[model samples]
Target: MRQRSSAEHRDLCALAPELSESLVAWWEVHGRKDPALKPWMFRADGRWPAPEEALDPYGIWIAEVMLQQTQLAVVLPYWRRWMEVLPTVEALAAASLDQVRLQWQGLGYYSRARRLHDAAQTLETQRWPRSLEGWTALPGIGRTTAASILSSVFNDPLPILDGNVKRVLARLKAHPRPPARDDALFWSWSEALLDPLRPRDFNQALMDLGATVCTPRQPSCTLCPWRLHCVAYAAGDPNRWPVTDASKPLPFQVIGVGVVVNAAGEVLIDQRLEEGLLGGMWEFPGGKQEVGEAIEATIARELREELAIEVQVGEQLIALDHAYSHKKLRFVVHLCRWIAGEPKPLASQQVCWVKPQSLSDYPFPAANARMIAALIDHLRADTLSQLS
Candidate 1:
């Protein structure tokens, strides 16, 4: 653990109580309290429940998991829909993986959904974990997530070190190093500042302060409750405190995607292997465009290699770009006519033939979803022209 000076430690201890109190007071007035949007935060009387009053653990778990790498506004509808559909751990565990993935469509980071389902299944067989170790034992539940869920649902005094809180802490102390470099220090800081009596509200208020006021860029320092004490604010550059590592350019790859249609007017799709990026999700069969290969050849080659089927690559249907956190992809989609051989999942977990309309039943990556929409429109136009 990186060590701070004795004087700095003393200063932090001295400020902890006042800091927690001020933030909690600000939170009482400005914390997220929308009953309709976040029903778990309120009681039947539509008031913020007391700290000792435990909220729905399942709801808190789902919300925290969804909020991982996703913003609050983006997660709101998804969280609401998930709660309505699954409602309980039993429902989520009993539901098919396909159903779970469908609910998580367009949410990105499909792994979170899969892990949530797995954890739900585990929870169905057991009881809700009360300790940090038990929660972290589950798939996808990291220290921060477990702490957030525990604090929110049980009013545990555990602290969270999420992205928002990290930024807040970094600015508060004007820490010169990136938070990632010394996360232990940040964790300690979070613990020191946490209000043991009302952790639920205190943690939420801290997150709200970061999300709304102490933002990543162009923070509203004037409105921030902690501005008076923020070291970064005193330095006249709050944004500079959370020093970031130099970023490497995201590698870009050109992918040739094949939309294979047979004489029966069914399109061939495949389920990716149940691991790695976009794992267990359905997508059009394709592969990276190799050096010195034509886009159409790439499509034909990928289909042959991945699905063990031959295809006559036809006119381009669409070409689109999609970016992940670590990579960028240009998917050059072409309509293909299934030429020969029974399709087999040589690289994927499974392959299926279905009408384009049925494609909606399967969860596809966002880029592939767009391709499906285009394929449907194209097919619809073809049918209309034939009828005319």
Candidate 2:
């Protein structure tokens, strides 16, 4: 790993000349074939796709918001469905909150959905943002996001520092650690360094090159347009260019969720606190795991702490594995029988013993969704033959 040094940044402005021609020429020949680098105007097979003329300002704005922390493949269907439902800002403004949130399920990052719903109001009759600053003023539009919308949607020359650009610049600049602390410098360099002759295409090309050719791991620098000018490739470790400190270990949060079943065979569940990690969602009761504590003990302590009822923690019902953006976690749910104390909602907003069939009506975290689905399927097996 290359150590952080002042020499890395020494007047790179002069040594690394702006190679707009290098990038544009590369895009002309090899770029059209690449899906990642294919701009809105062009398709991979050299077909011209006229999205701008077909898409209005409001549609483009909505597309930008949904793209955050979400993959292109995943966002496509949702985008189409959303556009059909709310063709204009006024349509989204008039729709109910629950209407949008339900379709937004599985995308994660609830706040983005909330803000996009809110921002639709401001953008409703206003002209499209002519500059980066204007785009940035919109709700949920951060610096990079604003830059991306301006450059991609409006065809402006604004630079983008999204995950794609971050990956590319990490290798180009060759730093190590999460780049948040150095973002200001990165943004300034991005905005200033591009060859202005083709700012829109150049910025988009860089991001495209970063995503496909100069990827996060095992970047195909040989196929990269910027490879000829990239200092990281010359340094013999192109993969190591975007440098950052090693990742902090994923914190383990162990908690026991209650699967309370009564004589009616209804399983008890609770609506999670609507403001924290799983706000406005439903999950079983649980808390963080203490170091060196047994699962049973942890469950007992969490029950007393969160639900205020004593319970006999039973066998493990099932284990669901899930990975979040920042951490990997396992949700181990257990079968429990409440022995004493009246059933009450202490930590949750509401509590209910939902029938096994009715579980599908409530929204659960992606991780919890697996266990809930499996349990419902298992319960339906016996009744299937009788119904038929």
Candidate 3:
């Protein structure tokens, strides 16, 4: 681990009293009132309607995975729709990859859906994992996610070191370094401060406090339950507690994206292999732009390499700039005419030709979705023009 400064060391070394009463009290007043916010529980008040139905392991697991990089407000509708469509582990396991991806459309991280599906298959056969080790052994469930599930369902005294908890604890400790830099120390503090008696409420309260009060910007210190206990607040700038080095400029890549349309007015899309980024999601066939290569040349070469076919690059459809976590991408999309051999799934999972209007039935990454929209609009305009 990287060395922490003297100030950082002092912030992390002290132990706070494990008093969660005030936090829990604050939660009762200001925590998320929606029952769906905590997926296992059926009621917003945290009261169990019935022991059997109160805790849906399947629902909680799905929610946890979706909630990984997404905010609660954004995931609510998606969660509700997902539950309505595929409520049980058996249902999820039985779902087709395309079906799962379609349901998870616009969720941003497609790999989570793929892993969730794989884990669901395992759980459907053997049943929900009882222990943290058992849960973490499954796909996509990490220490924090497993802890969240266990504590929420079984009231296990496991500590969660999620982003929210990290922020709250970092501020409380006045840690002058990012929590990610010293996770071991943060985990230790989390474990020490966890309320063993009411672990569920305690964990939820801390999460709520971080999200609602101890936010990344303009934190509501006056309303925070642990305001007095927060060392960063004492220092007078709570937002600056979890300090990070200046961010480096993200690298940019120019990519050639092709929207190949056939005479039947159907678009060709390929299923990505079930690994790496955007795995199992469908995308317009294209590749990275080689140095000094023209965008059209890059598209043709990529198509030949990927699908063993040839395409005549036609009108430029759109040029979109999208950013991933580490890099920026400039996708120069074009309306391509399929000229030679039949496109094959040589490098992808599968290749398909589908009507442009029915693209929603399949799942595409956010950038691909933009390409689809632009194609649809262009087709509509052409149709109106021909009619006129």
Clashes of each: 0, 9, 0
Tell me, what's the RMSD of every candidate? 1.5, 4.6, 3.0
TM-score of each: 0.96, 0.79, 0.91
* Candidate of highest lDDT: 1
Query: What TM-score does candidate 1 get on C-alpha atoms?
Result: 0.96
Q: Residue 42 of model 1: what lDDT?
A: 66
Q: Lowest summed-lDDT stretch of 10 residues in model 3? A: 47-56
1 or 3, which is superior by lDDT? 1
Report lDDT (Cα) of residue 127, candidate 1: 81
lDDT of each residue in 207-239, candidate 1, tens digit only: 889888888889999987887888899998787
Query: Model 3 Cα displacement at 5 (Å)?
Result: 10
Tens-digit lDDT track of model 3 for 1-388:
2444544545444534424667878887888745646555554457643322336577777888888988888888898899999988889999997899888998888889988888888888896788999999998889999999887777778989998898888888787677788888888877877777777777878888888888889899999888877788999988787877789999999999889988887889999998888888999999999999999999999999999889999989999999998999999999899988898998899999999888898889999989988998999999999999
Candidate 1 CA-lDDT value: 0.90
Residue 176, candidate 1: C-alpha displacement in angstroms: 0.8
Residue 379 shift from truth in candidate 3, angstroms? 1.0
Q: Which pairs of residues have clashing backbones in candidate 2? A: 170-241, 170-242, 171-242, 175-243, 176-243, 176-244, 177-243, 177-244, 177-245
